[model samples]
Target: MASISSLGVGSGLDAESIVTKLMAVEKLPLTRLTTRTAGYNAKISAYGAISSALATLKTAANAFYSTKTNLLTSTVSDATVASATSGTSASSGTYALEISQLAKAHSLSSRVAGASETMGTGSLAISNGSNSFSVTIDSTNNTLAGIRDAINASSTNTSVRANILTDTSGARLVLTSKETGASNTISIAVTDNDGNNTDAYNVLSNTNPGLSQLSFTAGGNNLTQVQAAQNAQVKLDNVDLSFSSNTVVDAIPGVTLKLTKENVGTPATVTIARDSTGIKKVADDFVKAYNDLHSTIVKNTAANPSTTLSTSTDAASTASALTGDSTARSIDRQMREALRTVPSGVTGALTQLADAGISIDSSGVMSVDATKFQKAVDTNFSGLQSMMDGYGKAVNTLVTTLTDTNGVISARTTGLKDSIKLLDNQKEMLNNRLTSIEKRYRARFSSLDTMISGMQTTSTFLTQQIAKM
Candidate 1:
């Protein structure tokens, strides 16, 4: 028997076209599986958007629970004399603050000498309060500039800073205590290699030259005290208080006072009070966050209203990614329930969010009544705080459960993913089966074409024999 080279040459049948059409029908199941998988992916993406919105809402809700009271703001009548800041521990009150003295750091100067003149080589032991460090002077670093650099570069020299000051007299090595306080006064003891530490009697004496010129200890008077270390003294309501530093924090409860200048006779009033603006801002943020989350849920779960027109470009139809989905519906229902339920363990006239001037409208959007909210904050701030705390705790708990690792949204997403995976596996199996079916169809058509060609040849032979007779 002869084999058919082309599909339809012998039988005059369009076998290739027929096989293609049959394969198209056979692929219907794969196409359906792909479409279903795409739908599942869309649902998963919709859940992701919902989770992000819920996370934002959770942050805003947590803020309300954390803020214990209205934020406090402080002011000073004389900002030039002093500035103040208040913290959560501060109580609303006014204090008459009188700054008699600002803190000063101790500064000492070495006897004037030539800018590049070298003093005798030795080691100088320097101290401020309990901190002490020694600087060695050699021929290489014996000059005034060299001594300044050596003192500053000492790794353990934490209490004092050294600098070279040039005047009409000459160059002087100036040492200043790094901190304020009489106890932080600087003292320098010298081991003069020249063997005469007390030989220099006057500030201008360079004759008995040695490292003793830089000493300011009781045994030597080579260095002069330029500035005295003193404490900052202030009077709060006729009570005297002193601090080692100008920035006073412990003197006032929950308040830090920064003394800039002395105003002994004239006292500045420091007032700390509740900040109404800050409270209102927090309330507004909470409402806005809830509205955003609510909007997202509504958009994802909204059903398209019945329409007579077949072709419609309405947003309602386009926005439905998880429409009729049980997970989306459950989340929406739980959130609405949280809003309607009254928070437990709350007391006072403003026990609920509505009582504190926060209300949800029929459209599921929250609104704040500014006048009412401010009135509640002014008259019953404690009550308003309690209500916010209660509501915030409740909302935070609900949002956490919904967006956590094993949350409803996460579970739904996981289920959708598993469904897509199954659909993909099914699609693979269906495609493999369709391949085998197409091969069988092609083999049968080729055999039929060869058989028909042989029959046509036999018919032609019989007609030739009859014509001869």
Candidate 2:
């Protein structure tokens, strides 16, 4: 009739220990499920690594496509004079670049006056190139600083930037054209409210007491031209060329020249040629990418031959999850096959990767032969490029098939995931069964403990009676 708080309290037997051992046996399936899940997860991670490496390889291969393989480099004899950039359309040639004058933006300075001096109310029409905007000068914004702010804040004033420059002479309103070139000259015309816009009497005045003094037009000469807007003049290959801006793009096909300084008599030579180093690097990168992908596959699918297995949980310590996996094997096989197959539309001594100085070793690692590759690039650049383009197209197609939604890798990953989900469900059911088994074991052990305790008490009474007799 007594209630026991702890297991095995009423009996000499260790009921708790027995129940724990029984439960451990009952939960064996759960442990197996856990191990299987871990294996599946490791497989997924291995595939992820392969996917990443394969994607990089795909990118490297894509660079060999016909549209992307232009590797021209431009060089300048004198960087101080000008720097040049060549594009795909640029033909290999040498150009004589002589910059006569650098394009200048038109800048005009008003007569210096007090920073807060109030000028007569009027409207000023500012023109730069074909763009023109009007700024109204009122009592609210008639001072030199106020006018500068108003002009800058004008919604339509996109061609000119207005600022007030303070010097010992005084504060002068400076207007600069935003664009450079002769046609972009800044001219300010005034509509004075005072009815005397010319202000010829104050033409030499530095104060600019009226808005008319701000005019720099045919009708009036008020604002002084600090810098003129002139086109950039250059003699490219002894041909005089004029550009609106200092950055000349149309002067040469696919070449942009940035004129930094004027070198009138001395001409700097610009050479456009095939970038042999860049071309070699591209070839090297393709080979390296393949090697990396190959390494990943090998590492993931390698067989562990040691009899003594590692107990470490680290993924690297254990046999790879992808070991003996059909998908991994197929990927490796397909990739190697792709490398061995000759690219279509490519003919010559440099038709295959090996011909272009890329070769695979016995261990399935690809390498580039620098000497041979350089020779191929120098002598058979077009042929090498054609081979690369064809190979790139083939490899890219293979990778796309392997990594696509319904691809081999994806299907394998999905199958593993499904297996994991099923295992998880089975584990849940097994856990529930183990929970019931533990409850039954505890109940049975409690009953056994109660019986043993009652029997022992009876035996002790009997022994006392026998001793008394």
Candidate 3:
């Protein structure tokens, strides 16, 4: 190692310890800056936490609002009502309505089976003049079945199939030409190898022999052709209309028509009645959603946001009160006011939420009485609908608080981020200034070391001179 005196002559520090001590003293400002930065970061993190929590809460609020309002809206306008029978609105103590749609039927065009086919348990050889091939028929081992599978397996020009009405009085083997538009006809000359049926080989075509009429059980909708469209002349609420399709179409409001019978036994009747399922479902969904919102509020601001009362308790209350703020209750009052105010231009069935039986409690949470709810469904659904209608504009307003721009969470988060950036800038400035201070301190230490080394050398020279004397 170089001598301490050499260190002093070179850079001015008599010893490294002197440089270290001064440097530590100069670093104090930097240490203070670092502490400030740490504090800033912590504040930013806390603000971020609050912003994120609010964002989530805002989302839950939106869903809760949408569900309750939609349920109310649907309950008012929807056509579904349970407990009402197929016909007669409220004529029976409990009844529902269902409308039926007509079924579509299709007919097949009889064309020549141009391709060759094996029929009725047999290995058949097919020849159309020069071109010929033999096909073995098997149902159990091979997925192939009936004459249709065999002919389809034949040459590309020909095809095979089965007719449903084969046993009918006009039954005939009518094979269709694959290319009826171009080729127009198919010729099949076959040699059957089934043990008992040798004479069954016949060329299938429109000219040779028509496939026999089909013989089978007809479905509930009889194939029997009617001269005109089958319809029942019925009075829907004293209004006369023809019922032709199933799921009876409603001729008027608050009614559903349905087919109670098909063909024969009794004259198929059309039932007209009121529907209540839509309203009841709305009320149920509203209750569930309201409870969810109430729970969220209680959890976030309550002694506990997630307080759930024990089932064994004499009274079970959901955690619903807003975070220690009675304002939450005020908010509910505002929501109720919003619900009560119905804008014009409403249409169909139920008109309001109150008509449908949705109400708010003093605590700001919605609470539904099932009995009152069902009674409203049974008696006046439009009133409940009106109550739901009041919330539309208000909900829209509340949802704005959650938007990414100008939203409660967004604004706060953005401000925090900016503060963090500023803090970071401040920290960098502090570091730069401290670095300059440290450099200055180092320079001063170098000068002090030089002075000390000069003194030490002078002392040595004096000692030597004095010894000579």
Candidate 4:
């Protein structure tokens, strides 16, 4: 192997040329990661724009879903209002509730067959002839835990589960048959229980919720038996809550309350409607979301260069188009009105957003008084509902206008994506051009090294001739 210097080349300049060529390869990935590699990057900017637009559209869609324009108007028309319950606002001691309907339930019990008792251990084997596990009893094995462990160790995917049955005497072990499809059962065939099958084993029953009533003392805590229902029972810190059938479900946050006609006379008319607090919260949320979106758009698109909001060329263009463009502007206007509109049927304090005690600051943000807004809803709920009427329809229309494939936001985003794609294509071509330029430079250096090597050989031969002279 000849080094560049050994090839009649005085300096390792050709080696430096290889180093420079390698540097170009290292820059390829770096260029991809940064905008400094600008002109050569394919439509990354457009891709970024489209991705952002998609994200915004999805976010807006989610907001639309969270919003409910329909009236929180669940009416408890009929009910056996044994004792009606109504929610109370912390504002006025008006927590007095009238149940619109009584709660209903079904008594639960099973018609399972009784069992025969069986004792200690046997070579319990699943269907396979040689596959089996043996149980050893040292008298202490009579306990439930011991039986459970023995069955589990039996090697079958099936477990030896036990249910404790209650009778006048005490708890008795009810073992289950592990196989599936009804025929699986524990069969005690008088193998060796002091000769009598009756004294030795009792076959367990699988009829009920396997072991519906099992209580054990683990660490001295006595677990009680109670019927557990699939749905959580509604309660406020454990105060059993009853709800009327006509009650609005979301009126309670993280809880359920019953409706019945208790306080309201004759027909037990409990207003199974949205709780004032919950409704106000929703209204407040809508106001905040609308305002937040408005502010974000304004900041992003604002003509002022001093603002900290993103005003990059693409972002600025989008902002301008959104603010001035009729579709974006129109939809934005509708959303604004939707948040401000009041339910026609509502009355009492603060009819409009202003009356609900909500106000927008100069920066286009909403602020509201928690106490005052709640009080207005509690006393005159219908009036408040009246104000919120048209907003739902308006929002649906706005969402369609902004997020639909042909909507304003969608159109702008699509255009941005296309433009970015084109820009990126141009960038890729430029990069290939740069690679060609660098490669040509390396080839020129290779030719120069060859020329230098030839000259060095000729000079060495001349020097030898002079020495001979």
**Model 3 lDDT per residue over 1-469, tens place:** 2333333465444556766677788776666656545544554454444444444444444443343333321111123221112222223222222322222222233223433322234454433223445555554312113454555555532333323234323333333322111112123333333444422333243332212211111321111221212345444334445543334433533334434432222222233333455445544554555455445444534433355445422122233222344433343344456556654554445445544456666665665566766776567544444444435434546545444587544564576567767767877887787778767766676666666667777888999999999
Tens digits of per-residue lDDT for model 4 on 1-469? 2435332254336556474767667566545534423421222333334335434543543433343333233333353432223332211111223433343321122112243322333222222112233454334443445544555655553433445465664445444433221122232211232333342323223322122122122321112312211222233222455432334344443222444334434332224355555565566666656665666555433454453335443443333323333444454465566556664444555456677676766666667788867776676655555544444344555555656677666566566566666656766776777778666765666567777666777999999999999
Comparison by TM-score, 2 against 3, better one: 2
Runs in model 1 deviating more than 4 A are: 1-30, 68-70, 109-124, 133-159, 162-174, 193-209, 218-221, 224-226, 264-266, 307-319, 325-345, 361-363, 397-469
407, model 1: CA deviation in Å? 4.4
lDDT of 1: 0.83
What's the ranking of the predictions by lDDT, best on top?
A: 2, 1, 4, 3
Which number leads on TM-score?
2
Model 4 weakest lDDT span, ten residues long = 208-217
Please list the residue runs of candidate 4 whose C-alpha ends up more than 4 Å from where it truly belongs after superposition. 1-11, 14-274, 298-352, 378-380
Over 137-200, each residue of candidate 1 has an lDDT whose tens digit, in order, gives 8889878888899999999998899898887878888899999977898988877675554643
Give the 10-residue window scoring lowest on summed lDDT in candidate 3: 213-222
lDDT score for residue 389 of model 1: 82
- Per-model lDDT: 0.83, 0.84, 0.43, 0.44
